[model samples]
Target: MIREPDGSIKIYVRDNRHPQVIERQLRNLDVRADVTFLPPGKDCREPRGTYLPDNPALLTSEPPAEGKDDYWRLHPEQIKPGQTFVYTMWYEEHGDNRMFTARYRVATGPVAPCEVVPGGPVMKEGPEGGIGD
Candidate 1:
């Protein structure tokens, strides 16, 4: 997690391998979160719009019935290989509050590295709190 100078935090997941899919389980994340996506080998990061059709079906606290585990499902809508998935979170406390943390583990699909950077805010479209964020 990257602590910003303005007291915000930036969490990112980077895919550096062949084309693959990534899923993140959000057990906490009680505060406001802005999810952004960055293209492969590019610095431009844009907000990933809502995952419709499956938006309501996706679980943010518990896994799906067919899910192997019980955790919220968060993934990039169109993240290809070498792309970066970033989720920036902001809290009212503005300090070291560990309550808004998300955990990442090895799944059966692919393996990617996570990084933290300086960022803030995000754009939104469609419904509110899309993807259960």
Candidate 2:
């Protein structure tokens, strides 16, 4: 999650991957969000926390809002569109267990443009410096 100058958060993906089950679970848990952003490659990052202030994570860091913090939700204004953010893969698998889950940590940075692969339709390409095809 990249923090904007205004303190709003912007998650980036060339395009959106909507209607995923994770999103459904978030809704069930009362998390209000629009879409999921993906980096060019499957690997990407997740923000561990934000820096609004010494305690930007808590709304109370600024002003008192009863017992709850206004920033407690960590929801920022609008995520600047077209920015590309990604994840870093952390795989865990026991010697005997072939199954494993991959975790990611968000890295703050910018993603240059990219091009589509040749095997896919439209016969497109990505920016020379962009990650993944």
Candidate no. 2 TM-score: 0.21
Give TM-scores for every candidate, taking all chains together and pairing residue i with residue i: 0.20, 0.21
- Model 2 Cα shift for residue 43 (angstroms): 5.5
C-alpha local distance difference test of each model: 0.29, 0.29
Give RMSD (Å) of candidate 1 vs. truth.
Answer: 15.5
